[model samples]
Every structure is written in structure tokens, then in C-alpha cells.
Target: MLKGLAGLKAAAAKPNSFARHGVATVLVTAATMALGLLTGILVARSIGPEGRGALTSVLTTVQMLGWLFAMGCGKAVTYTLSRDHSAGGRLLSTWTLILLPLAGLAIGTGYLLLPLLLAAQPPETLELARLYLPMIAMALLSELMLGLILGDQDFRSFNALNFLQPAGVAVVYVALWAAGRFTVEAAVIVQAAMSTLVLAAATALLIRRHGLARPDPALGRKSLWYALRTHGDVVGGVITQRLDLLIIPAVLSAKQVGLYALATSLSWLIVSLSSALATVVMPAATRRGRSGRELVLNSLQATFAIGGLLGGGLFVFADIAISLVYGPSFADSALPLRLLLPGAVLYAAAAILLNGLYAENRPFTATLANLLGMAVTLGGLILFLNSGGILAAAIVSTVAYTLVFAAAATLYRHATGLPWRVFLPDPALLAALPRRLLTKPSPVAAAPANPAGK
Candidate 1:
């Protein structure tokens, strides 16, 4: 069995088309996950439940604001730059210029609102929220840098920075705690410092490698418009994903909101795994025509299988995992985690399907699916929040994602003229693929080469 597994591994690494890039991405993802787990443990140990809850609330708010400012341009940067390198470079510069002022405005807005929003909270927690708001804003620069690296397909640099940023923040926080300088305010300061350093380094590297000497203003404008259209799904999708977080705080008590936040954090692991696969397959998917259908089907199959396995494991171990990482103070979160687990798995599969639509330039379809999903989620949450508390929130969120996934699969079939049946996962078919993987040598042929190769 050991020799067979070794042989299978060798076969998997034969440098065939997407497989080569996929293998590399898997390595990067593995490293990122490892570092992220360590960072999570450190944060849990250092700050405990209250700190974790505060960080979750602040980060969720920041994520929504950052998504709004970027306008989904980050994903668009990758797709656009991959299609036209020179044009992409100019667009990247333009986007950076546009985002700088926007980031400032967002930071100012968040800072101004912090006191008003947290006025009712405990004095210490309110103070912590205010201290963290600026750090969230500072991280926007790092996010922009990430967009540029992804646009250029510099996954090596991107992944390195990905691991570094979180790990750096964790290490700084731990060091500060060890030295008796750790406070919620100090943690925010450390976060700001790390974001500044990473953003500067990433921006400098990307500019040195891919920056246009004199970017054409006309080209930049055109690329910006095109990117907006191309990335509409991403913009809508972010709003849809974040709706519960954004609204829950308004409707629920701080403690209830905190429970929902904890559940959402657990769900994020599903997304992280899905994102790893999507990052690997996106470039390849863009190069195909009819063959993209088969690629999407195959990807969904793998994603669903993996997501199901992991989600199930998480569900089974939810209480233990929550207690271990977050301590017994957060035991209230276990049931919410279980409620969201299946939905999280479905959300993961949906993400890959949405990526497929984006590759096919069917952003309209993707956007529609996301909007519909958001409607379902919000409507359900409103109806249930009054009757049932955090559990209702989890159930509604799961239902929303399931609907979204179904919608995406339906739209993908309609757009590509692919049969709806193709969306369904067939365990028999997947079981049959291993023999083909071994005997055929190549799992799939290479996507046609594009001149840009951004």
C-alpha cells in the first residue's frame, strides 16, 4: 500500500498542465494552513474568548469595508491581467491610485463610527474596538498589494506573503505578551506595523517586476470599466457572504452576535480550502471553451467530496475543537458550528462553481445567483431572529448558501449549454477516475496557451 501510494504521488507530480500549478498551489496552501493553525492557536491562548470575539467582530467589519472599496477589483485584476499583460499593468497602477484615497476615507469613516457603534458595550471592550479600527484600515494596503500579486500570477510571492503576514502578526502579539506589553491596544499596533511592512514589500516587488514605465490613462480607464463588469459577481458575492455578519450585530445582543461570529469563523475553514483549489484552477479554466464544462464538473466533484469529508469531521468534533482552541468559555458556539457545517461545505463547492462562471465571462449569472442567495439569507434571518436566537442565524445562513450553490450550478449549465445532470457528483464516476489517472498518465490536456500568460 505504501509503494502504491508512492507511485500514485509520482504520477500526480508529472508536470502536466494544470496539475503542475495545482501541485504547487497545494504546497503553498499546506504551508499557509499550517501557519494559520499555529497563529490561531497562539491567538486563542493569548487573548482567550473575549479577545477572540472582539477580533472576529472587528475583522468582519473590516472585511466588508475592504470588499466594498476594492469593488471586487482584486479578482478582476487576476482575470484581466492574465488576458492582457500590458493593459493589466496600467490597470493595476490605476487601481492602486484609486484605492489609496478610498482607503483613507474608509479608515476615517470607520474611526468616526467606532465610538458611536460601541457606546453600549463595556468600557474596556469599547476601547479595544476603537484601538483596532485603525489597524483594520491599515491592512487595506496589504489587501491591495495582494490584488497586484494575484493579477500577475506571482503565486510564489503571494503565498509567501500570505503566510508571513498572519504569522508575523501572531508572533508580534505573542512576543508583546511575553514582554508584558500585550494589551488589546498593543495588539492593534502590532497588526498595523505588520500590515505596513508586508504591503510595502509586496508593492515594491510587484512594481519592480510588472510595473509599466508610463501607463496609458486611456487603457487604465478601459480596464477599470471592464474589470468592474468582470468582477460584479465577486462584489455581490462578498456582500452576500457578509450580510449576516453586518446585520446580526444590529439585530442581536453583543453576546449573541459574538456567538454568530464564532460560528462564521469555523465556516471560514471551508472557504479557505475552496479558495486554494479555485486559485489553482482559475487560469486554466479561462483558456478553455467547451472544455470548461468538463473542468467545472470535475472540480465540483472533488470539491464536494473533500468538503463533505472535512465538514463532517468538523461537525463531529465541533465541541471538542471549540473547547480546545477557544477554551470552555465559548462552549455556546459548538451548536452553532454544527448548524453551519453542512452549509459551509456547500458554500465551498459553490465557490468553485462561481469561479467557473467567472472564467467563462458569465459574471452576470454569478451575480444574480449571489443576489438571490443574499435575499434568501436575509429574509430567513429576519424571520427567525425574533423567535430563535443564534441557532436561527446559523440555520438561515446554511439555507442561503445551499440555495446559492444550486443557483450557480443551474446558471452555469444554462450559460454553457451543459446538462444540469453534469452538476451532480457521482461517486461511481470519481471512483472510476483513479484507474484513468494511472493508466492515461495525463488527467486532462493542457488549456490552450494564451500570449499574455499574466
Candidate 2:
């Protein structure tokens, strides 16, 4: 046991490979996912299904607007910073001066347009949506700082920061639950406060480490171009992710939307495993440039093996899990949960390919892949969403997700010259594997003992 322990330490924790870094990121993601689930349970129980739907509708709307106007700066920042460390200060300066104001403007725009989006929603839902619009500003800036940490490959701090939002919300919800005050409005207010806390913490971290400097016009132009190039992918990706949430309101009753929201919230808990790998893969891909195909392949292999098992388990236990955790009223959410499990896993794996494409300076390929998936989802919803209700939404999503993975895999192959079989993982290894051992940590993923080091 002692020998095995040392072997494990030597293999993963020190050198900061995807094993080391991936474990850290994935572990934190798991913690956050668990916390998020806890928060979801509290919210669902406190408000019941329809109130949860109203809350979800407002939250989803804000997320849609924020990502819609995000301009793809996220991946662009990470890709750029991985290649050039010197741009950190200027990136901070540029975001503060330009991006912050733009975010405020976007929030204002969302407010003016909020009622239109939530028209089908109840009047209270529309009010909640407007109340949540300002949270979009907080989310945008918080994400910007987090992006910089990720771009710098400070996965340690990145993971740490990522943990805080969910953690804070979970704590507040726990308090509210104890006080018997965990209403939908309280949940919304708690989330906004947490967002402000995260943004403030991230900003302080940057200022102490590197004082803000003047924006570099050249760097801003270059980063903004890449951001805009990847912008379609960003917007498309968010649209794809949030479209189901958005559509459930218009086509289904508020109660139905509530059920769908529970399904999705549960789905993300399992899906975050692959997303952790994709998070590590993106910056690592930028660092590897064209040579990163093997990393992407390896991560995808791990994603498939891990995602498949977890998804299957959730599929089998959806009914019990829903009833046990969310109570019997949410039992109906199980079918949609089962339907979403596989498609969500596929979408999670596809993220690795898309990130690789973007990191390799092939944002257009990523953009096309995103648009394809988005189009498929949109078309599927338009033709069949009303006819089938949430079940149809689930089936269409699964199909769309599968198509996206296929398109991304094919495009990834054409772009990187990787064989198709690389998309498949070995069965024997799948049965006896830990993710860190799946691939050697790349040099780009290695960190100094210092968390804030250059």
C-alpha cells in the first residue's frame, strides 16, 4: 500500500500533467457539481416545481444574454495567454476599460428585451428575469478574470476560484433552508451576491499579482479578432447548451419547464467529468499547437470510457435518485434525465475536440462545428418540440449531441490528420483505468511550485 501510494504520487501530483492537473480540475469540478446539485435540491424542494421553473427561466435567460454578448473572448484569451505570458497585464487593462462597459451595456439591452424573451413565462417569472439581468454583468467580469487564470494555465487557482461560486451559493442556500426561507427570490439574490464576491476576489488577485497597465492596441486587436472568430463558437455553444432550457418555457407549461430544468441540472453533475478534461485540454492544446492531436485523442478516450459508465449508472438509477433526492413530485423528471444522460455525455466529449480545434488556431473549424450542432438542435426543436413536449426535447437533444460529436470528430480528423479510430478507447484499459495515467502530462501543463509564477 505504501509503495502504491508513492507510485501514485510520483505519477500524477508533482509533474502537473493532465493527470496531475486533470485530477485537480476534475476533482474541483466534481466538488462544485456536488455543491450545485445540493443547491438545486434545496431550490427545488423549497419552491416546488413551477417556482423552480420560473427561477430557472430567469437564470437561463441571463446566461443566454451574457454568453451571447461575450464575443468569444474566453477561448481567445486562454489560447493567447498560453502562447504569450506577457500579455496578462494588458488583457486585464483591456477588459476593465472596454469589456466591463460593454458588459453593462449588454445587461441594459437584456433588461429592455427581457419581457419579450419571457413573455410566455408567468408575470412573476418575467419579474425574476429582470431582477437577474444585473447578475449578467457580474458573471461576465467574473468569467473574464477566471479566463485569464485559465489562459495563464494557473489551473490550481482556476479550480480554486471555480469552486467558490457554487460553494458560496450552497452555503447560503443551506442557511436559507435552515431558516425555512429558501424561496426562489432568495436563491436569485444569493446567486447574485456570490457572483459579486467571485468577481471581487478575482479582481483583487490580479491587482496584487500584476498592477493593471495600459491596454496594448495590437494585443487587444489580435485577441479581439480571435475572440470574434471564436465568437460564433462561443455564442453557438451557449445557444446549444441553454437552448433546451430556453425553449422548454415557450413550448411547455411552467411546470413542464420545471421538470426539464431538474433533468438538466442533474445531467450536468455527471457531464462535468468530461468538461474537466476539456478544460485542461484547451489550454494544453494551445501550448502544443499542431502536435496536440494525441492529447485530444487521449482525453476523448478517457471521456468516452468514463462518461459511458457514469451515464449508464445514472440512466439505471434515475428514478430512484430523483425520488430519493428531489422527492416524488420530481419523479417525472427521471425519464427526461435518462434521455439526457447519453446525449449530454456526447456533447461533453465533443467539447474536447472543439477546444483542440480552437487552440490550434483553427477557430473557424470550431465555429463551424458549433454552428452545425446548433443548427441541428434548432431544427429538431422547431419541427418536433411542441409535438412531443419534454420527451421530444430530450430525444432531439440526444440526436443533436451525437451529430455534433460526429461532426467534430470528422472535422477534427480532417483538421489534424488523426485517424478515426483514435476516437475510440480500448476496452481493457477502460475497465482498469485512472485518468491521470491515460496520458503523460504535457510540458505546457506543468506548473512551478509557485501558484502565481510566470
Candidate 3:
């Protein structure tokens, strides 16, 4: 009986195209959410609101700068490696060769511009931002390695490493707080150090699993060109998504930024399903010649069930959750948290649609859609944020996401001719999810028949 139970667990863990990969990603995403919440709460309690605000600002700035400099190598690496896994080593090497110099330039430029960009911040906060400078290279390299891992389809390692940085930060923060040394500078340093360690681990894993290949100049140029064309989509999407955070420091108090950050983080617990979907869908979609119709449809149905249930739960518990996780000082976060639910759900659907377009080789379509969303989001913030503050930002976010979803979904449907009804949840697929969870990978999916070689 014990032997049989072991076999059953193994079978259950083995996933194929639809339910299996989705389940694994969902589980990982759930863990990431939990860790993020735990860390957020700890940070909030340790430093209080204003410090939390400064920390959020620095972290957000680090990510934005990293992406700006990384030059879209994340997606480029993924696309290139996905197309031909045999070239995985060379692709990884090429991206590393390109990313190092770019990282330096990006960091140097950010340093020069820091005084202007963060002029509103306190001197201490600015100091913390400077301390986080090393993250520029670390964050960029992390992105490149993440793309390689995704392309290699090493979901286990991917999931493990994804959770490590946050978990590490949280643990370190708690220790520092206990030691009475949990200042903003210490926290920032801890975050950067933890992130760098995680990136190093991932790099070691990639090299161990797929030994490095000599960098190919031609392939490197091609990847760089592709990344350049499509990088805007990623940059725009992230900017729109995190635009509110960037804006809050300028227009609102650090305390308010802290509150808004808490609310969005809670709401993101639901919206982040889109990320999980994108992670699994991108490589799979890249493999199939078609728009990955079956995968997208099934994933959409799953997203609806998963995202809807999670979003509804978040909506209902927004107040209690905010209080429990962030303390009563952040209770004001509930209203914005409630307002962000619709956008979160909408964004989840749009993420899948955007990835579908990428899989279909219509990257420009995805880029344009994100640009539209960014414009709407930024314009709304500029025009209404002065009077309306976080609530207005929330409303604008929902509207912006709605427009983005419509644009991307229309393009996907028009290009693929897959009917609107196909995206709707299928009772059969929902029912099959449980069965799929308990079964081994299908022979077809295991063989990776898709031409992309994933």
C-alpha cells in the first residue's frame, strides 16, 4: 500500500500540455503569493509605513532600470532557445556576453539621473537607492537566466528559484529586525544580496544542465534585433502595470504610497495568475506553429476558474487581509484593493491573449497593445491623479486593462479565426482538470512534437 501510494504521487506530479503544466504553475504562483505577503507584512511591521514606501520605490526603480538596460534579452533568449533547444548553450552565452556591458551602461546612466528622478525623496531614501545600484546587473542577469530556464522547460528549477529570492529576503529581514538592525539601507542591501545569490544559483544550474556553447555573433545579433523590436511590449506592459507605484512617490506621501502598494500587492495576488499563465504558455505557444489555439483556450478557461475564484476571495477578504497582513495602519488599502479586482481579472485574460500573439509570431501586435495600455494608464494618472489619488489610479488601471484585453483578444481572434466562444470555460475541461492532475504526461506532449523543439 505504501509503495502504491508513492507511485500515485509520482503519477499525479507528471503533467502534460494543459492541466499538468497549469497546475504546477498555479501551485508555484500560490507559493510565491504567500511568500510575498509574508515578506510584505514583515517589512511593513519592521519599518513602519514610510520606510516601506521608500523600500518599494527603490525596488521598483531597480526593476525598471534593469529592464531598460537588459535590452529585452529575456524574451529574446527565450524565443531563440525555444526555437532551437540544441542551441541553448550558445544562446545563453550570447545573452550573457551582451548583458554585461549593457548592465554597466544602464547602471551608470541611472546613477547620473538619480538626483533628478528621485529628487522628491528624502536623503536617506536616496542613499538606499544608491545602495541598490548593484541590482542593476543582478536583475538583468536574472531575467536572462529566467528566460533560459523557461525555454529549457525546467519548471522545477524555475519554480524553486523563483521563490528563493523573496523567501530569502523575508528571512533576512526578520533576522535583521530581531537584531534591531533593520534599517532601510540594511534592508536594501539584503534584497540586493539575496537577489544576486539567487541569480548565481540559477546560472550555475543552467551551466550544469546545459554546458555553455561558444557565443555565435550572428545568432547574437539576430536575438538582439528581435529583442529590440519586441522589448517595448515588455517594457510598456511592466510600466503600465507598475506605473502607479512609480507615480505615487511624486504625487502622494510615502505613507500613502505604502498603503497603495499594500493594496496592489494584495490585488496582485489575483492578477499574478496572468504571470503564471504567461510563463507556461510562452514556451508552449512558441513550439506550435499555429496560435497555440488549444493551449490558449484551455489556459483561458483555467484562468477564468482560477483567477475568478481568487479575485472574488480577495475582494471579499480585502479588509481583513489588509489588516492582518499589513496591520491596521494599512486598512485604508481596502478600497483600492477592492477597486483593483476587476482590473486584475481583466489583466489575467489579457496576459494570455498577449502571449498568444507572441506565439503566433505577431510580436508587434502585442507591443502595440501594451503601448496603448501604457498611454491610457499614464494619461489617466497625469490628468486625474492630482485630485483623485489612489482611488482614481485604481479606476484608471481597470479601464486601461479593459482596453488592453479587448485589443489583444480581438487581434488573436481575428488572426486565428478561433471563435469567441472557444475562450469561454468548458465544463468538460474543468472536470478533466482533476483527472489530468492524477495522470502521467501524455505520450505526445512528452515527445514535444511542436516544431519549436520545446
Candidate 4:
């Protein structure tokens, strides 16, 4: 089994096509979501809202700190590695050296600032947060490794790692529940423990494939500059997804944060699906021609149709689902989940379009687009508190995501000189998807589009 798995990963080392990889990944992502949801329900049921809220706050803080100091290196490494697959060793070494100290710095900084970051919480929450501060490193390593794997276009290995971590988490949660030893602290410990093991396994794979070599000064400089260029969009995109959790504490109660956290967690089920569709897209987009265009177009269509259906099902059945799985305590989460559905699907589509900007070396335009969305969110938050007290923050968030999708689609077309109609799903392609998914890999050649034609 071990040898066969290794062979699979070897065969998956940068495939020339995205079709099978995308479909398989979407399935894997859906399973991960299931395991994740199970773990969440277990934890939420055991801890209740306030305890769950405290846990959520701490976890969010740790995750935010990790991304805060990441400086977009994860995505940057992906772009750099895709351009020079031979640099695996140097890239691995260089990024390892850079992110370790940055992670350490993030841990130190976050430790000092946890008081401020989680100020909305109680003393017990703050103390528990400080205990798990090292999760900052775990989060950073997670991002770096996943980005590298995806950059290699080895979605099979990528899917393996993705599947393992959540599976471990679910197993751990199940074990704890059976043992009657579940608590927020227990949840935190099990998550970090599983993460540590997963990261170790991933690092071992990287080392075996491309043994750690000295960091190349020239490559290091180039990678750093590239990371900086993409940093704004990277950071803005993360903050946009997470800012609501952090900010909700200030305006609402801790319980509301918990409710909103549950809402967002469920909402990501759709976003991750969107994301899985676009998983290989950025790398694929850089390959000039008809194949790249078709790849993007198909991804857009699949994401829209699949994401819309999932989002809609959850939207309509949210109240029952929340109550059925998480009980009446979390039934209130249904409304927020419903409010976030449209935006969630749109945000996923925006993510797909933004790949064009990155591929075109127009990272700043991508950054500007995300920044616009973030600006709307922040501005709306302020307005929501003052004048729209009667409104839910989820409504504002949905509007912000809608604007981001609009901006991203417009920017992607303008940057790539592609027709706007291409941004929409083609009915023919949608109809052909089932047959295509069943067909063998036939990588289409990239024939350049007519320079004079729209």
C-alpha cells in the first residue's frame, strides 16, 4: 500500500491537465468538509455557545497571526516554483528558512497582543489562547506546504494531505467524545497535534523528493519580491474571509461571535468547493492559448453551477440542518448562513477570475480588486454599527462579496483581453461536463487567440 501510494504521488508530480485533478479534488474537499463539520458539531455540542465562541476566538486569532506574518510567501512560492520546478530544493530551503523565523516572530508578537486581539473575550479565553500560541507556526507551515504542493500541480498528493489532516481531526474528536473527555482545550490540543503530525509527514515527503539544499540568494530575492507583489491580495483575501469573526466580537456578544463562526464555517463548504474548482487554475492560466482559456471557462461554469446548487440547498435547508446536527442552540446560525450564501458563491467565482490577473503578472490589479472589497466591508461595518443597527453584518458581507466578484470579473477580462461573455458559463460546456469527466485525460494544445479578435 505504501509503495503504491508513493507511485501514485510520483505519477502525480505535475500533470499537464486539470480535469481529473479538479473533479477528484472537489470530491476530496467535500469529504474534508464533512469530516470538519462532524468535528465542529461534536465540539460545539460539548462546549455550548460561549465555550465554542471562546474556542473559535482563540483559533481565529492564531490563524490570523499566522497569515499576518506569512507576507504572501505561500502563494509566492507557488508562483516561483511553477516557473522553475528544478528549484524545488532551493525553494523549499529558502521558504523554510524565511517562514520559520517569521512564524516565530508571529508567535512572539501574537502572544503579546493576544490581550488586545481577544479583548472581547473573558479572562479564561485569553489564558487558553496564550496556551495554544504555537499554533501560529502550525498554521504557517500548513499554508506553505499546501501552496508548494498545489504549485507542483500534484493534486493527488495534495488531496492526500488534505484528506489526512481532517480525517485525523475527525477521528480524534470521535475518540474524545467516546472517552467523554471533550473540551475546548482538548479540541485545541487534538487539532494542533494532528496538524503537527501532518506537517511532519509533508516535510518528510518534500525532503525525500528534493533534499534540503542551501537557499539560493538569487532565487530568494526574486521570490521575496514576487511574494511582496502578491502580498496585498493574499492578505486582503484572508482578512476578508476572517475579519467578520474578529470584528463581530466588538459589536455583538461572544455568543454572536460563536453563532457567526458556525455560520462562516458552514459557508466555507461552498467557498472551498469554488476554491477546489480553481485549485490548478492560476498555474494553468499562465499557459497561453485556447486550452488555458477553455480550462478557465470550464472552471467558471462548474463552480457557478456546483457552487450555486450547494449554496442554495444549504440556504433553504439551513435552519433544519443546523438544528438537526448542532441542535437548537445553533439554530440561530441558519439566518446568517442564508444571508451569506449568495456572497459566498460569488466570492468563490471572484477567486476563479482573479487567477487571470496573477497569471498576467498583474498582481497589483488583483490586490486593488480585493482591497476594494475589503474597503466596502470595513465601511459597511462602521455604517452597520451607527445607522444600520437593525441590520445583520452578514447582509453587509454579502454586498461586499458581490462587489468583489464584479470587480474581479471586470479586471480579469480587461487584463487578459478576453471577451466578457467568456466569463459566463457556456451551456454547451456545461452539458458536456459529465461526459468530459468520464473521459481520459486529453490535454488540449494551447492555440493562441486571434490578436485582433475580441
lDDT of 2 by residue, 1-454 (tens): 5764464344344333656787788789888988988988887788889888988888888888888877777777788888888888889888666577878888889888777667678788788778778877777777678888888888888888889988999998999999998787898888888888888988898777667889888888888888888888887777677788887787678888899889988887666876678987888756654335556666777787768778888999999989999899998999988888888899988988888787667887788877877887888888888888888888877777788888888877776655555567766545544543444533323312111111
- Give me the runs in candidate 1 sitting further than 4 Å from their true place: 1-17, 111-120, 123-143, 230-232, 251-255, 288-292, 426-454
lDDT of 3 by residue, 268-382 (tens): 8887854477776877667654424566666766777778888888889888877876788988989998898887887888888877776766666678778888999989999
Give per-model TM-scores.
0.83, 0.90, 0.90, 0.90
Give the per-residue lDDT digits (tens) of candidate 4, residues 1-454. Answer: 5764463343334333456677788899989998989988897888888878888888888888888888887777777777678888888888878889998899899888887777778888889889999888878887788777767767788889989989998998899999999888888888788889888887888888778899898998987887887888877776677777766655566777788888888988899976687777776555333335556656777889888889989998998899999989988888888888899999998888777566566677788778888888777877774444314678878888888889988876665566555556667667776345313222222223323211
Rank order (by lDDT, best first): 2, 3, 4, 1
Candidate 1 positional error at 239, Å: 3.0
- Per-residue CA lDDT of model 1 for 1-454, tens digit only, reads 5764563454344325444454466567666666566656655666665565565556666666666666566656666666666655576567777667877787777777665555434567656665566554455556656766766656677777877777788678668768866655666566667777887788778778777556567766755665566456665677567777766655556666666677777776776775566764554565443344455566677677767877888889989987887777678989988988887888888888777777776665677788877788768877887688788888888888888888887876666655555567667646753222112322222333222211
Clash count for candidate 2 is 2
Ten-residue stretch with the least lDDT total in model 3: 445-454
In model 4, state the lDDT of residue 111. Answer: 86
TM-score attained by model 3: 0.90
**In every candidate, how many clashes are there?**
0, 2, 0, 0
